[model samples]
Target: MNKDNLAARRAALIEQCAEQRVGLAFELNALRPSKVMAGLPLAGYVAANRKLALGAAGAALGLVLMRRKRLAGVATSALSAWKMARGALGILAQLRR
Candidate 1:
């Protein structure tokens, strides 16, 4: 009968739509992390609150200038340590490969 055919077609369409909805949900979950990172408010808030941002930057600059000698020594030590660690890591990675 015509009505039976129409009912079957409607059910098939509904099933197809449900399948598509599940696929869309999975894709959205996969994209959620990148979406959250892209939507972080820090940069936007800093742009909108320029005075606060500048004040923070100025404070940091003042601190660094006041401790220039000590900071430079620490920085040099840290850079050397980092290079050593990176070289060790590179050797480990090459061994693994």
Candidate 2:
């Protein structure tokens, strides 16, 4: 091809690329976190009660730190209870069969 035709084709391709990029950016804007969050019911509630949510989170963290040992003990007891109950249930099932 002639230089003029080659240059014209390159310019056309560049213009097409620019248009595609602009279209892609516009499409991606809808998928942004803020835009997606705005559509969620929980997001709206959290946005409306931001202070309450933050306060609750802070209180939970404080409780975990202050009662770490107690929490660990309670968790261990709960796990043992669960295991015992599971074993009992298995025995009962075998007896039924």
Candidate 3:
């Protein structure tokens, strides 16, 4: 068999062994018994909700990060100017005046 087929067979064998050891029946009927949802299929609904939520969240995060970066830059420039003013004042005071 090809490499892909061989890998798949190995995976199946491992899963079968694990299932047998765990006393699980080897059938699709072994699906989670408590997860049976009796309702109309809402695959489209789920997909739309996921798309919208992801888009909104990404936009919000991008805006917040951009604002944070802008504010940080402004703060750094202001602090630099303040330091320069203080240094100039100190130098002037040391002169004869």
Q: What's the CA error at residue 3 for candidate 2, in Å?
A: 0.7
* Candidate 3 local lDDT, 7-57, one digit each (tens): 999999999999886775534445643223323245445444788878878
Candidate 1 lDDT over 1-97, as tens digits, reads: 6999999999999999999999999899877755555566886677668899999999789667767788888779979999999999999999999
Clashing pairs in 3: none
* Residue 63 miss distance in model 1 (angstroms): 7.2
Which is the leading candidate under TM-score? 2
Q: What ranges in model 3 sit over 4 Å off?
A: 1-66
Task: Go through the candidates in order and give each one's C-alpha lDDT.
Answer: 0.85, 0.89, 0.73
Query: Sorted by lDDT, highest first, which candidate order results?
Result: 2, 1, 3
**TM-scores for every predicted model:** 0.38, 0.41, 0.31
Please report the TM-score between candidate 3 and the true structure: 0.31
Q: Against the true structure, candidate 2 has what lDDT? A: 0.89
Kindly indicate the candidate among 2 and 3 with the higher TM-score.
2
* Residue 12 lDDT in candidate 2: 100
Measured on C-alpha atoms, candidate 1 has an lDDT of 0.85
RMSD of each: 11.3, 11.8, 18.4
